[model samples]
Target: MTRRCIVLLSGGLDSMLAIRIMQEQGIEVEALNFKTIFTCCQDQSAQVARDLGVRLTVVGQEDDYLDLVEKPQFGRGKGANPCVDCRIYMFEKAKRFMEQIGADFIVSGEVAGQRPMSQKRRDLDRIAHHSDLDDLLLRPLSAKLMRPTLPEREGWVDREQLYDIEGRSRKRLIALAKKYGLKDIPTPSTGCSLTEPKFSKKVFDLMDAPGESRRWDYELLKVGRHFRFNSQTKVILGRDEAENDQLRYAHQLSDANSTASLFPENFLGPRAMLIGPRTDEAIEFAASLILRYSRDYDAGNALIRVDDEIINASETEQAKALQTIAAS
Candidate 1:
């Protein structure tokens, strides 16, 4: 019988190489791509699965994912990223996926010390144990360094054919890619918004707010200049045409918390989404921000559309009254 394995293909070079190595060992491979709202590059992952001729499965996190982000049991990285906790979550799912598909084991491209937060030798061990994967999880890139897994001990995959690569250096991995006749190398990145400091600031803000931060609110964070007026009030100003369209679409959602959306009626400027009360003070504040970021500020007679009505920007105070939380 041909042994099968599920590889965590993140569309990065390391994961791609992991798949290639499994194929070289005459093992059947399936690609699994896990996506959270904050992750990027799914299209690239699809293309990679096609190049390697393996079936790809894309899975998304449940609302419980938000719980982990807000209060991580294992703690966080430099930013708000809960790297260790995140990996455990991913693998717990992968373990189930392996069982569902009747795969012999799970494989990943994780180098022993490549990631400071999650790939430390001890961290790797913790993830395997906590995820309940244990010896069933295999890191082909650093297999030689780890104790023999079921695959190697049972002769399902040759340990000699696997690698022992570790640490931050990519020279050996890059050379191996060439040796496998692989092209289309993707630049290395964490591929997660939580890893960025500025993005994490907005995440912290949403989590710290009084009420719940639903999916819509987190989705909005990806597309605008965020400003906090108070605990219950905040405004998001689009930075470009694309963002303006996004803000408009967000306003139309049935569960949208945006009390009112303000758009430049008589001048060229960004749109704004007002969350919380639509008091006159808040409405005028949104209008003032539109003028503050207007590309054509020379148009002194600028008007703002609130709902279906047009209104002049009354400077309740000033657009810069509150500190800008996140830009664009």
Candidate 2:
């Protein structure tokens, strides 16, 4: 019988190379791609699966995935990314997938010592143990340096064909990609917002907020310019026309957390969403921001629309000052 394995395909050079190695050894491979709100490379994964001639399964993070992001047991990296906890969550799901599909083992592209947060030698052992795939999980790119997994030990795959690649250098990996005739070698990137410093700041701010941040709050982070009005209130301003439409649509959602939407009624200006009480003062503050960003700023006290009612913009100085403080 032909051996089969499930590969965690992240649409990167390493995962693609892993699939190639499995194919070279005549092992049937199935690709699995995991997605979270912070990840943005599903399309690339799908394309890579097609290129590799492997069946692909796409799985999204469950609500519990947020728990790790909010408070990672292993702490975080340079950014908000909880790499160790996040990988454990993914591998746990992959274990279920492996059983569901009757695959003999699971494989990934992780190189030992490649990633500071998640791919340390000790971290790899912790992930395998925690995910309950102790000897079933294989990292083909670094297999030679680790204990043989079930596949290798059982002769399902040749340990000699596995690699000992580790660390941050991609010189060997790039050469291997060319040898395999793989095209469109993607550049190295985590493709996750949680790994970005600026975005991490926003995530940390939300985490530090008084109340628990909802999924909607996290989703909104991708859409607008966020401003904290107080412990109970935040304002989001659209930076472009498309984002303005998104804000309008988001505010109208049945489960939206926004209390009010603001825009310039008589002049061109960016739209804003209020995520807390739409008090008169908050509305005025939001409108003042609209005025500051409006194209026709001198169009005599900008007429601002607050949901259905029009209000004269006020608190211009206060809004400007607050924005300055936030930026600084």
TM-score, each model? 0.94, 0.96
| lDDT over C-alpha atoms for residue 118 of model 1 | 94
Cα-based lDDT at residue 97, candidate 1: 94
Q: Tens digit of lDDT per residue, candidate 1, span 51-164?
A: 999999998998888889989988898888999999999999999999998999999999999988999999999999999999999999999999999899999999999999
**What are the runs in model 2 whose C-alpha is more than 4 Å off?**
315-324
Q: Give the residue spans of candidate 1 off by over 4 A.
A: 295-301, 315-328
Cα deviation at 22, candidate 1, in Å, is 0.7
